[model samples]
Target: MQRRYVVVIVALLIVAGAGGLLVTGVCRVRELAARMNCMSHLKQWAFALHNSADTFPVERNEKQVSAFLSGTIPNADLPPEQRLSWLVSALPYMEQSHVFLQIDSTRGAGDPRNQRPIENRFEHLICPSSGEYDRSSRTWKSAGPLTHYVGVAGVGADAAALPLGHPKAGVFGYDRRTAIPNDIPDGTSNTLLLIETSQNPGHWAFGGPATVRGLVPESAPYLGDDRPFGGWHGNHTVWSSKKSHYCIVALADGAVHSLTNATAPEILEALATVAGKESLPANW
Candidate 1:
């Protein structure tokens, strides 16, 4: 009986060890899959932007009718013909043309008539990684419009915050350097375009943080690590890697790159600018 008991104990221990390894493997894959999904979203948006850029010099009537929003202009003072974000405009390119048509471009996105598109839960665009959400409500959507990614408006809160005569040096925002893909003097692969974040991502159809965001450095404590513990994830703190130490960003070339949280602020600045001409660190 003693020998039999010893054998059973050893068998149980082996099974537990195997189970632990299997669980660890599954968790690692889950994180990797989430990261891939995040990257895929960035690529889809970037390709749409590229297609939009290809067909520029659009007619004023076309812009107003199609709700084809522009991010290069600063709408706060001299707003565009339509106060829509380019995300709405690029819907057609992303194969989501139906959602684009639902919006009544005759008025602002907040117009009562445009509620369907504005409040829509574009599941494909939502980040599978992190955000404050309630899965227990038997709901799989955000209360309002949500976007996990935003256009990089150079290295500030937005393009308007840059110094006078300074280029927006980004693909989107008030004074963007790359209105067309060719405008990126620093090479498309070397520039930052759309980046993923769990910060206070404003409305999807409306303007503001919903569309363009500035690439600020000095992210000593990326909120992703502490946010799951109930800290405020607001104040424009960028969070791409949920419960992680890295962030995912897409370049003008439609390539997604994983950046470690420890990446230098200057390196980030270099990538954000269109013509900074700053060299990256070795092996970066």
Candidate 2:
């Protein structure tokens, strides 16, 4: 009887161990699926951006091209509030043409005509890893719908402070039209375009709040804090995996890469510029 009892106990222990391992495997698979899904979302945006550029090529005369999609035209006597963003301009290519048509580009994102589309959530823009949608936070309050991704505005101490229409090294400048292939002197493959961030203003319709203006080091802790560049993955602050600190970024070439927090800051800065003339390091 004693031998039988011991045998039964051993079998139960083995079964429990196997069950734990199975659960762990399943969880890891799910996490990987979410990451892939996020990558797919970035890919879609890249495709739409390239298509938009093709449809509306930039004029040879830089002055003639609309700078940031701000609702107001440069040198025009329009109020600052009349600004719009690249996301709004690229709507037609994203298959959101109906929403795009509803927006009056001449008016600001706050215009009532843009309310419906601005508030509507785009599932593709949300990261599955971001968890349940909670709008109670300050980032989401009155910010319209939330977005997991944002554009790399430029490389500077404060690119966001620059006046609208000023030249930005990054692809999405203020009040600017879509960047063409020729604009990216660093090669489309090297230029950073968009990034997955949790610190967005949650307003996909506007551009001012959807851009990362400066080069925040990848090693910077993902404090999951409220900072604009902070991570939003649960209690973890950075947008990285448990095994490593990393984030997903899309290049102008339409390729998505998993960048680790250990990535060289100089490389990150160089990637944010269009004509900085900087070369990627050998290791990169």
Candidate 3:
């Protein structure tokens, strides 16, 4: 009788352990699926950007095309700074056909016609791995999420002058591999174009921290706490694991990799410069 009781106890313990393992495995699989989806989202975006460049009109006369559309044209009625966001242009190619139709590019950005609620199809803005942010304050969070991706704004306003009249100047567009594909005098690949980032504007707002400066005319809504793209946070979690690490960026080359907090600041700077890729340190 004693032997039978001991045997039953052992079997029950074994079953419980296996059950725990099974639950953990299922969670990991879900996490991995989400990350893969985010990666696919970025890869598709990069391709769309390339296509836009191939199709958009190109004119050599600086300040001819709307400066909002081309970095090469500067100090015009509409500065290159006023250009439509690359994300907005990518709607159709992203399988967001409905969204593309809703946006009215002909109207001014501030026009009420441009605003679309998340239910209207903007939920696609978020990434599974990135969490939401607190709008009342600029900070990291896990609620009220917005997007799981972000856009690269070039190095700074100073660098903007270099590609001043080129169609792809304000950003590290696909042509970053080459100068506006023959327009700009000098351009280089391995130069950072689009990078994977959490859409939390609080941390990574276009200009900088909100405390340091006020919001820009174009980015006020995004900076709102209700939106998730308020901070500059990144993701760093092990494959098949539930725990998350800091920011990890997806490169224009379709490479999804980690960018640790320990990464050198110069490495990011080097990746941003149109010419910096040529002089990359051998160690990197």
lDDT of 1 by residue, 1-284 (tens): 99999999999999998997777677667667777776787778887777776665433423421111256333454353236666777788888888888976656665678777767666556666664343456355556767777777676654534542255446665433244334566777888887777666667676666667766444423324442111222112222223435577888887888776656667777777776778886677
- For residue 61, give model 1's deviation from the true position in Å: 25
Clash count for candidate 3 is 28
When sorted by TM-score, best at the front, the candidate numbers are 2, 1, 3
lDDT of 3 by residue, 132-158 (tens): 432347444543323455544344433
What candidate 3 gets wrong by more than 4 Å, as runs, is: 1-19, 57-84, 95-98, 116-119, 122-124, 131-145, 156-189, 199-250, 253-263, 277-284
Relative to the true structure, how large is the alpha-carbon lDDT of every model?
A: 0.62, 0.62, 0.42
Shift in Å, residue 180, candidate 1: 3.4
| Native-structure RMSD, model 3 | 9.1
Off by over 4 Å in 1: 1-11, 57-69, 72-82, 131-139, 158-168, 175-177, 218-244
lDDT of 1 at 220: 29
Using TM-score as the measure, name the better of candidate 1 and candidate 2.
2
lDDT of 2 by residue, 1-284 (tens): 99999999999999998997777677667666777777888899878877765655556555343222322223243433345666777678788888888777777767787677677667677776776343344242333476778777666655544443344456655544444555666778888778777664456765455533445544344223453342432222233344434477888888997676656567777887767788787668
